[model samples]
Structure formats: C-alpha cells, structure tokens
Target chain A: MNFINSDKIRKDFPILQRQVNGKPLIYFDNGATSQKPQQVIDVINRYYQHENSNIHRGIHTLSQEATNAYEKARTTVLQFINAKHNHEVIFTSGTTGSINLVASSFGKKHIHAGDEIIISTMEHHSNIVPWQMLCEEKKAILKVIPINDKGELLIDEFKKLLSPKTKLVAVTHVSNTLGTINPVKEIIKLAKTAGAFVLIDGAQAVPHTKVNVQELDCDFYAFSAHKMFGPTGVGILYGKEAILNELPPYQGGGDMIKTVTFEKTTYNELPHKFEAGTPNIVGGLGLAAAIDYMNNIGIANIEAYEHELLSYATEKIKKIEGVRIIGEAANKASVLSFLVDGTHPSDIGMIIDKLGIAIRTGHHCTEPLMNRFDIPGTARASFAFYNTKEEIDTFILALERALKMLL
Target chain B: MNSIKETQQEIVEEFALFDEWMDKYEHIIELGKDLPLIDKNYKTDENLIKGCQSKVWLHAELKASKIIFTADSDAIITKGIVGLVIRVFSNHTPQEIIDADLFFIDQIGLQEHLSPTRSNGLLSMLKQIRMYAIAFSTKADA
Candidate 1:
C-alpha cells in the first residue's frame, strides 16, 4: 500500500509517541475515538488562551470573538458535510447526544402511535436506544431490517419494511462493529419515496470517508468530532432546514432561547434551538482545525489508502490458523473484526495489547447485532489513514503469538 | 459508614501495591468475583444491562448505611472482573462512590483490557452504581 504523509501525520499527534505497556502506542481505536493531531490540540489551546467566552451574546470582546469561531466551526462542518447552510449544522456533545436530540425532537413531533421507524440490525446502541425510547413513549413501532451473514444490509428486506406508516428511517453509514458500509444513499432514496425522513449515523463514516448530505439527500446526518481527530464533547448534527424547522427543541436552557416569558418561552432558530447551555467553545475551534487537517490530507486519498490497508491486513489475518474475519461484506470501511479459535476476544486483546498493538474487543456497542451473529463479540482492528503496513505486520505477528499462547 | 475520604483512601491503599499489569488484572477479576450479584429472581429486565456480550446481572444492597452492589455474569472472566470492581468501590455511600475518584482506574492499568463497547458497559455499570448510590443517599438525606 502507498504510504500516506504518515510520518508527517505521525508527528502531529503527540499521543502517538506515548508508550503503553512498555511499548509505543499503536492506537487502533480510531473508530471509537481518534487521537487528536497537534493542529487540533493547538487550536483548542489557542482558543482558550486567546478567544474564550460564551458565544452568541455579550458586548464584550471575547464574546464576539468566541461567537465568530463557533459559527466558523459550523461553517466548517457545513463545508465538511457539504451541507447547504451553516444553520443546519447543530453542535452537540457527540453523535449519541445528536441522535437523542433527533429522537426526542423529531420523533416526538413526526411519529404517531402506529407509525414505524426503520433501522437496520447493525446499528449502534446510541441510534437504537433513543428511537426505542421514543417509540415506547409514542406507542410507535420499531422495525429492524435484517443484515446478511456478511453484515451487509438486505436491501430487499429494508424495502419490504418500508410503507406509508414508516415515519423515519435511521441507519448507520458504516458499521462501527463490523466495518460494513451500508448503501445509505439508496436507503435514503427508498425511505424518501415512502415519505419518510432519513437520518444517517455518520459517526463511523465521516473520519474515513467523505460525506455530502445534500448529494446523499439524507434529511439528517450525525457525527462526533472526537472520532474525526478532534476534541471530545463536540459533534455535528446536520439536518435539512425544513426538517429541523419542523422539529422542536431538544433541551431548554441558556442559548436555546429566542425569548422567554412567564407563560411562554420562544426558542431560538435552527441550530441554536437544540444547543442548550454553555457549548464547548474550545472544542468548536479544534473541530474546525481538524476539518482543515482533513482538507489538506484529502478524504479520497485517506479512504483509498485505508481500503488497501484493510485488504492487506485482512489477507494476512485470514492466513492465521482458526482466525475468522467478521463482516465480510463486498463494500466495507477500513475496520476489520475477527475472532480466533479457542480464544475469547478479551483474551486475544490482552495478549495483542502486550505487543503494543491496540485493538478493540467485544460487541462494539451493537450487542443486538452480536446476538444476531450468535457470538459474544469479536476483536476489531480498525485502520485509519495514519496507520501503516508495518503496523499491520506487527498486528498479525501479535495475533499469531496470541493464538499460540491461547491454544 | 466511613467517610468518603476514608473509603477512597482505603481503595487507593488496596490498589497502591500492584506493580504488574497481569497482577493488577488478576486483582480486578477477583473484585468482579466480589460483585455481590443480586438475587436470580431480581434478574428481571430492569436489572439486565442491554447490549452486553453476555448475560450480566446486577443489583445493589444497602449495608450498614452504605450501598453494596452485587453482580454476576454468565461469562466467567467478566463476572470475576465485576467482582473486582465491587470489592474496590461497592458498599459505599453515594457521596463516597462519587468521591472515591475512580481515576485510579487508569493508573492501575485496567482500562486497557476493556473494549470500547465493554468500556461503555463498564461506564454504564458505574453510572448505574453511582445513580443507585445517589438515590439511596438522597433518600437518607431527605
């Protein structure tokens, strides 16, 4: 595989130099939360030191400066997702909070007792629980589309699940557990025909791939900044203006107010309506800087490089005795999940960790999917553009040793 | 019940001696064994944690002005690990649970063994435990 600006990229992340268990850290948990680059960290530091204040109000100098940076971060997100307007971009705590906002706001208004909300079998609990709670509250039905044994969504099954009663279709763009990239655009198209709004959980897709909400025609898209090499407690929820306008506010507090009275409190317009309380100011600037970093490296290049890494890693991992790669879909993102014979995933992870090759083990926030597969969980080694082939070799060797030790 | 500071100090002392990763891990599993799993009859849907790789059962017991947590899992090692957590942090008042500053979790070298999802589960367990403690303490205070 062609090496990325990997050495240059490596220098930008100080945490990469960190040693865990007497070895240099090889963080494979990017799919969960990527380590931030120096650029993002520096941006955060610069913001706090130079421009720190509550945004959207105040005649003070820091307030205006903070407001500009925060709104600029929204614009950056708009450009990143190719959303039509900055107003559609809402800052949230993270992807889960964003999804919950939609479930609470949109689901509360748009759904009725008999209406159905369709999701796939391979959804994160964040996507599932919020909707389940909403469905339970509204007496609406929750429909799950089945995935193939290879972890690809059965489009036919999804189509069958669609009906006039289907109010919303929420699906993950990529499986955080299995690396399955669902045909989200097509799903959006089908759901649209059924008069259903679509929300794409891009938490797993945004860091590795390019997403255009307008081009994809998804009504709503949610992603976490931390997973894309930015700070924690920051995320983006991009919604079409029409849908966002139709939904109610998620939380009522400081910034979300347009005006307030004893009898009635008017909420703010799009974006601000959902962002209540003091938003993460430094985190916003950090996210903008992270977007800039991605712009330089190029998402297409990263996706291509990671595709090659996954194939290469998958090939070597498959050669190991009694190793089974999970989620073998025709189309997948960079993450690879697998299990070793006669060894628990936790056990395999423990040994591999000693070799300084970090990997995620267990259900990956999709226990229902795990139950579908009839396995507890798998050991997952997800690759980002910052990863190299040598890391893959180290990982394979660790797996071999772990297998021997466990056997 | 002991003051929150005293319990935290005790927890720190219990873990302060461990130097090796594997040794620390063994201690954690043993704590999981200490997890005072609630009664099987209590294993209703409410006690069940959704999205677990295995059947994990949990409940809390109030012991001498403190909340003691008992948990069990069908998965052997996971159950053992749960026991370890219970030994370290369970049976404390809400103030104590919150104040105990489980930050030692990272220093003791336990977070590395956990998967992100499993870590999520652990956080959920901790949250539930803390929430339980808060409820109990709120009642006691009220």
Candidate 2:
C-alpha cells in the first residue's frame, strides 16, 4: 500500500484551506460529495481553456483532441474498475442517470408482468425510485431485502426472495446513510444462481475502496463522479459486454444514431448507443484526473486510513452521553451516522456549522431507511483521507457543544 | 403588539446581543419553547409547510382583521424559525403582511447561519405566511 502523506493531500484540495462562518471549514460531508483536488480542477480548467470542442464530430484538430481526451477518460474509468472491455463503460449524467438508463433500457427489454426485482431496505431513493417506476410500468413486483437492527442485510431473507422469476437484483455496495459495506460478492453469486442480473450501486463504494467488476461478476455497476472527488455531472454505468449488446439504447439523439432517416434510423454500437448527446466532456476529463489522483494515493491506503478514522470517530462519539450511533454493521466504511437523544439532527447540525464543522443532516435521500429506524434523520459525519484526527477531535468537541446548546 | 417593523427591529436588537452563534441558536430554541402552537384540528396536511426537513404545521387565522399565526415543528431549530416568522408577521393586517419587507432574517445573520436546505425551508415558511396573507387579502377585498 502506498503511504498517504495527508499534509500533502490536504494541500492538493484547495477547498480544505477555506473557511466557513468565520472559522476554518472542516468538511466531513464526503458521503454527499467529496471535495475535488486541485489536479482535477486544473484538468477541467485546461479542458475548457485549451481543448474545448465537440468530440467525435468534426474532422478538425480540436475535435480530434477533444475526442481523444474524452475517450482517454473512459479508459481511465475502465482500468479503475478493471472492466474487461472499453465499450462496456457507458457515461451518463450521474449514478441516478446510470441506474435510470439500465432500468429504462434493460427493464424495457427483459422485464415483464409478474417478474420480480429485488433491492434493499438501505438503498438511496435514486436506486429505489427508478426500479419502482420500471416495476410500475412493466407490471412487475419490487421486493425489498430487509435489514437487521444493526442495518446489515439479512442474507436469509434475500435468499428467500430470489427465485427463477427474479429478473434483476439492484443493491448498493455501501449504504450511503448506514455506512455498511455489503458482502456483494456473495450477493452477486446468489443472484446469478437465481438467474437474476445484478446491478451494484457503487456510488458510496468507489471513493473509499477498490472495486473490480470482473471479480464481483456483477452485471452492472453504477457510480457517480461527484461522490469520488470528481466533477458533479459525470458518472459511469459499467455493464457486461454481452448484456450491454443485448439491451436497447436509452435515448435517441444526434450522436447515438448510425444512420437516420424519417423512414428508418439505426442505433450506434454499444457505448455510443447509450451516450445519446453531447456528454459532460470536462466532467469526464475531471473524473479521470480524480481517478488518477486516487490511484497515486493508492485505494488500499485510503481504505485502511479511512477505516482507522471511522474506528477512532466511532469510539470517541460513542463516549458521549445520550449520543446513539445509528449504523453498527460488522463491516462498515467512512460514514459515521448518529442521533443525539431529545435533539433533532438538524438542530445539532446547525450548531456544529457555527463551529465550521460540515456534517450532513437529513434523510440523506433515504426516507424509507429513516422510517425503518423510526427517526426523522441522522447527523452524518463522513470522512475522506485528507481528514485528520485533529479534525475528528474538533468535530467531537463541536458535537458536545451542540448538545449542550440544544439539550 | 408592536408594529411589524418595530417587532423586526426588536428581534434584530435581541439577536445582536449574542456574539456566539450557539447563543443565538439558544435564543431561537427558547423562542421555540414560547411558540403559540397551532390547534390540533388545524395541524392537518393543509397547514404543513412542504420544504422543511422536519414537519412544521402553520395555521393562520384572521382574528379582528389581523392575521394570527400559530405553528409547531418537530425540529427545534425549525420551530425557532417558525417562532421568528410568527413574531414578525403575526398580529398584523393582511395588507400589512402582504406589503411588509421581512429584512430581519438578514439583519439577525440567521439567513447566512442556516444550511442551504434549512434556508430553503425558512424561505418556504415565509412564502407560506405571505401566501396566507394574499389569500386572506383576496377574501377581505371580496
């Protein structure tokens, strides 16, 4: 594992130097979106400044340069996830867009009346709603895999739900709200046995850990660039080559067509068929730059350091009276979600912000999960590698101050 | 009750005394504790504000030609926000509410202090109060 020099890492992210509310900002909202490094920001700036052109259209030099840069970004993503082929990686707006693409394209083609689609209790609304819409349209059944009080998925219940009629299983690799790192390898194997294709929402996973799609053998992997320290508008939908070839195109537009006429229009091949229009070219390049930044730091190091931070934070936060840590799965990641007894998460979050501590306070786009816990929401302090032990201490102090003010 | 501007000015002066945001939020929470809660019957879906993270029900009634606002929120900070709104806009005529410029939020530094979403909720609360004012004004004119 490469050594993470956090001092250098902090400097790479310009936002880390900034202040909020007259105090130096302590950003802990990595679950919502990670802060971009200067490298990625510079890449975006350079793209717009120098290589700005419509890709794959004109025979001009600038267009060629743009096309190369955009496709190079695709290659970087392919290697980042260890995807088998180039054409399998489809660029979409974000994780939501990627999931919607699969649900619309794959669901329209394969899913039918009485077919069952399985998801989890802990999925973000982005993962849940698209499948729900697909089920509603196709007259299919949407099944949820229940979780234990610790917020871990009950594998027994999941096994019971899977059948020959199960068309697809969509689950998150990491729970955004709970911080549970799912046993996805086993889950994927089980779904395959039931002849169900699996789509893992890697939005929460890609930043903190290494993901190899071939080893997991998930049919589709969806994730957002913004969550992984890249620009907001770009994301990846990595489908198996054969499965992608079989699915229909998501949208019809200028770029996605092979030949167009009023009478007949032929769709373009694998990746381009899905990428319908002018893509977020700068965002794509920026995402690639982010991937490069992560690779240089080494994902293994990030995972280990983040694990330490989580453990340290958990222990410190657990010591506080009346403070209940929300998720306690055996396996977890960078998220530390909690609620202070008799105090609303928002009230806690507001007070903490005064101390320049940024934590997410809401349903986190997971209302059903909040409903399951019978709470309004949680104040989530998620971490990135650049975050220090000092910052965590400050967060703990701010939280204590907040509790004193509120309760 | 004081005039709307007077009430707003009073709130500004009150908030100005607290140098720390924690103290200001403490004052807000205290004000929340002092809120004139909406009647159980009026706490229906119709009175619930949409944008808040917590459930906030606000009921406005025209009593003696003045809009009397009562509210309740599940979240303390939001309740405080509702309390602040009620203190400014309540006990005023519909025309007064409709025309009143609510600059106290900015003056008290409450606008910058809240999260973007919370700010959105505050705006929604203010809008709902103004909406009630417009509706009552239409009725008064009719």
Candidate 1 iRMS, in Å?
3.9
The parts of candidate 1 lying over 4 Å away from their true place are A1-3, B1-142
**lDDT tens digits, residues B60-141, model 1?**
8778878877776654456655665676676666777766666545654566435555543565676787788778888888
Return the top candidate by DockQ: 2
lDDT, candidate 2, residue A396? 94
lDDT of 2 by residue, A200-297 (tens): 99999999999999999999999999999999989999999999999888988978999998999999998899998899999899999999999999
- Residue A253, model 1: lDDT of 95
lDDT, candidate 1, A1-407, per-residue tens? 45477898889889888897798878887787888888888888887778778888789998998898888888988899999988999999889988999998997788899999999899999999999999999999999999889999999989999999999999999999989988898999999999999999999999999898999999989999999998999898889998899888999999899889999999998788988999988888888999999888988888999999899999998888888888999999999999877667876676667768788887888989989999889889998888888888888877786666445
lDDT score, residue A283, model 2? 89
Lowest summed lDDT across 10 adjacent residues in model 1 chain A is found at A398-407
